[model samples]
Target: MVAKKREWRSGRRSVATKLVQMTRHLVVCEGTETEPRYFGGMKDALGPANGRKIAVVVRGSGRHTLDLFEHAEELCRIAPDPYNHVWLIFDKDDFPSNEFDLVERKCGEVSSSSCTFHALYSNPCFEIWPLLHLRYTTAPMDASSCQKGLVDALKREFNVEYRKNMDGLFSLVDSRRQDAISNVDKLDKHHKSIGNDRPSTMNPSTRVGDIFEELGPYLDKGD
Candidate 1:
């Protein structure tokens, strides 16, 4: 006997064909303040473009990198509708190399199923990614220097002191969005030419712009 396929009905119309699918995103950040405020604004600034409502769920629970990864997994487990993508943002400020490597591996493992769990990481701090928005610099700096430069630049350009929980932070650097992405790519190339094998360890380096660009399709056109 042949098996019949079950139909999903939505008031007489097939639900699958009648409704547009939106890509749900779960983004857990290591920073409870800075990352959420920035990414939340980024999410809020988007609209349903290309028939995709890019929804980003930013979780800021003061979790570390590994814990953040686990949090994203937990979200996927608990959410009735699994997210299309799960992103764990990380800052390798003082984290050990083992932890960093382990987190990356765990994300890789979790990404094998339906959901794609991505690890978006910054070298020293998340501030470095935002600092690239202000100016292009590849100078090697530690965590403290990165934070100081970011704070100073924000104060000078926007006339606002760098606060972790500042709302609408994405708008402040929205105009230079492309520039920030360009700077990140340029910095990576610069590092490669200089014999720096580990770009992530290169101070002021980040793949945050990559995630931004992925979400940019829905962002730039609408806002």
Candidate 2:
């Protein structure tokens, strides 16, 4: 008599599961050290209660913001179908306000054919300063002073020496990046809670929540 074959089960979790248990890669530009700090945590923050799992990657510094478009070009040349969803974030600086059209055009030329691309711009620099300001300060804080206050908060929290004014904020985020990576390892084993609240893809409003909300339809839409 012929024997029946047994089905295989994923008793053991994989590395990607630890990241966000994602089927599609969520590519993000203007990589933030603070915002979307960890893959799992960001997933929790941006994920809806019933939404599918999402994975995130911060491409690099926005100083080379346009380079990300070229990177997308290379990606399309290779697999082409690997990334079904892509989100590009950048700061509005160096270029004039009227130059947004040009930036969007460059991104479109590379990203239009292969994946779903959404370009988000933060004035001056990252929206993190504004987000943090909104969280801590009452009135709107300038990017420069917001940077100072954030650095002070982190320094006080970590008990570290204070650094420069505007640039100090970067250090605060830099410190958190490690914590995020470490948390990834832990999340591999357990469903850990991230940030100050529960994970909800429905509401992407926090600091720079608009970007999260804007990207929501694309991230959660059925294709």
Candidate 3:
């Protein structure tokens, strides 16, 4: 990941200096390689804090489904400074429906005044997110199909092959972020229209855009 330098500044030097509190975020991902690499790229893109107003920490636990959510909760509890927001990222790849649904439910129950928890899940697989940057579809896909779609889309759009742990993956798709977010909204509406509310049953669906929406201000603009 390429690092960028950023400067923090207050409006102006005044007789009375104002203190700015940094907003902290903790993102725990289930996949130890792919998810971590993508978010690590995000952190690098946001650049060095340099005592900035936002601080983001990304971690990957080699756990699945509910276990990943529990790990996130535990990490939040032990952090020196309580996180303002905690996001758990996981995929619904062959996980039992009950186990998948429980994590989303648990996120709602564990939120408090100090910290808010959000479940950012991808049905089938996380590859759906990158694929959305290239095209939009409402077709249901399993893990294999989702990855195949990503491979085709990457080759078609970027002339590159998709790899699970590809370095700088975030930068590769950063330019079409708005397109992905728009597709996510459409997919969400499609699921709702069909009366599909459960994450496990919502094939071809992903809430990954929720994290992007929350961290929009801190993200680097793409050309």
Candidate 4:
């Protein structure tokens, strides 16, 4: 006897065809704040051009790189459906001295076979946004020092109280990111105990298909 082919049903349509038709696209930011600071407000900035919705998911603040890795497979499953076009942004301090590789590995591990990945790097963390702002704007300010220029710009753009608040918040949040790295000793112990990488929920080679395999019934059935 011939094995029956699995068929999915949608209203008056085959679900498998709809799934195949879905456009896969996304702009995934490493940290929560970088996207808003850079691309969120700018309409048509890096527009998909393929008529796909622009979805942005934060991997948490700069501190959540490892956490993001742990949940990478889950993230791929949760991403916008169908088509797979993604841009993964990373900060220079992601793995202290290896941000590029970290971002690359993460994207590779979680991305579907249909998805394409782009990795962009920013140095010293989300401070990349501030650096970019300084590079393009002078207003009689010095661009020789990106950090100093950013500080000066922040001081001038906002009132004294707001400036202080911004600095304090940025520093406080950034410290948490720094702490995430500093706490690696504990992570090492946890990894050794589990006989696997610590803090990350899945191995670096885990694929999006692994997670979606569990969602076979719930997924849309269309091309």
Best by lDDT: 3
TM per candidate comes to 0.84, 0.44, 0.89, 0.41
Which of candidates 2 and 3 is the stronger one according to lDDT?
3
**How would you encode candidate 4's per-residue C-alpha lDDT over 30-146 as one tens digit per residue?**
566634343342222324422443333334334344444444445566654643555454444425334344765676665667775544444334442443322333122211344
Query: Best-fitting candidate, measured by TM-score?
Result: 3
The lDDT for every candidate, in the order shown, is 0.78, 0.44, 0.86, 0.39
CA lDDT, candidate 2, residue 166 = 33
Which stretch of 10 consecutive residues in model 4 shows the poorest summed lDDT? 202-211
TM-score of 1: 0.84
Write the number of the candidate with greater TM-score, choosing between 1 and 2. 1
> Better model by TM-score, 3 or 4?
3
Q: Model 1, residue 113: displacement in angstroms?
A: 6.3
Better of 1 and 3 by TM-score: 3
lDDT of 2 by residue, 92-138 (tens): 44444445334456656656454566555444445333334323332
Model 3 alpha-carbon drift over 4 Å, by segment: 1-14, 49-51, 220-223
User: What would the C-alpha RMSD of candidate 3 be, to one decimal place?
Assistant: 9.3
After superposing candidate 1 on the true structure, give the runs of residues whose Cα lies further than 4 Å from its correct spot.
Answer: 1-18, 47-52
lDDT of 3 by residue, 128-158 (tens): 9888988999999899999999999999888
